[model samples]
Target: MPKKRGKKYTEAAKKVEAALAANGDGGLAPEEACKIVKATSTSKFDATVEAHIRLGVDPRHAEQMVRGSVVLPNGTGKKVRVAVFATGDKVREAQDAG
Candidate 1:
């Protein structure tokens, strides 16, 4: 068996292990995992959860590579502005918006 950790570390580890076991052998679905993460979080402020995906494409091969951009249905939390170059009405609209 491994040596015992400090009190805080031991408590944190127990919470993590309990969370994992609560999900069971077949494993938790994405939504279930998110719930468990939220429930187990100790932060005072709201925490954002993210998932990382690894694709099976080889970066060395140009044909196997994928590149694209997507606009989220709900925009990012940060504020953004668009710049336009035009004459007359369009310019007036852009200036007013800016």
Candidate 2:
């Protein structure tokens, strides 16, 4: 099969790319990125980016954080567990299907 080219980079993604490039070899670490995100980006979703950036998290890490939190392969460091509550049947269905 022919390898397909990826979709065109998004304008926002381009901006991020340029910003990183401009920072050069000693570019922004995750923590620094998060700080910049916190200082500039103002949407609710951006907060996750900010936190990741501040923690020196990588782009993929930032993406995962924004996508939604998840358990790590190693699992939570503790043996404790918690229950999740759903507000409605739809949410329950989504949880089950997911």
Q: Using lDDT as the measure, which candidate wins? A: 1
In candidate 2, what are the lDDT values of residues 1-98, reduced to their tens digit? 96654344344455567778888875677766765555555355734431323445565664645345877898867886546666778677867765
Candidate 1, run of 10 with poorest lDDT: 24-33
Look at candidate 1 and give me any clashing residue pairs: none
Instruction: Find the candidate with the highest TM-score and give its number.
Output: 1
What C-alpha lDDT does candidate 1 achieve relative to the native structure? 0.75
lDDT of 1 at 60: 96
- What digit string (tens of lDDT, one per residue) describes model 1 on residues 32-55? 667667766767998787875557
Distance (Å) between predicted and true CA of 70, model 1?
5.9
lDDT of each: 0.75, 0.60
Clashing pairs in 2: 30-53, 30-56, 31-53, 31-54, 31-56, 34-53, 34-54
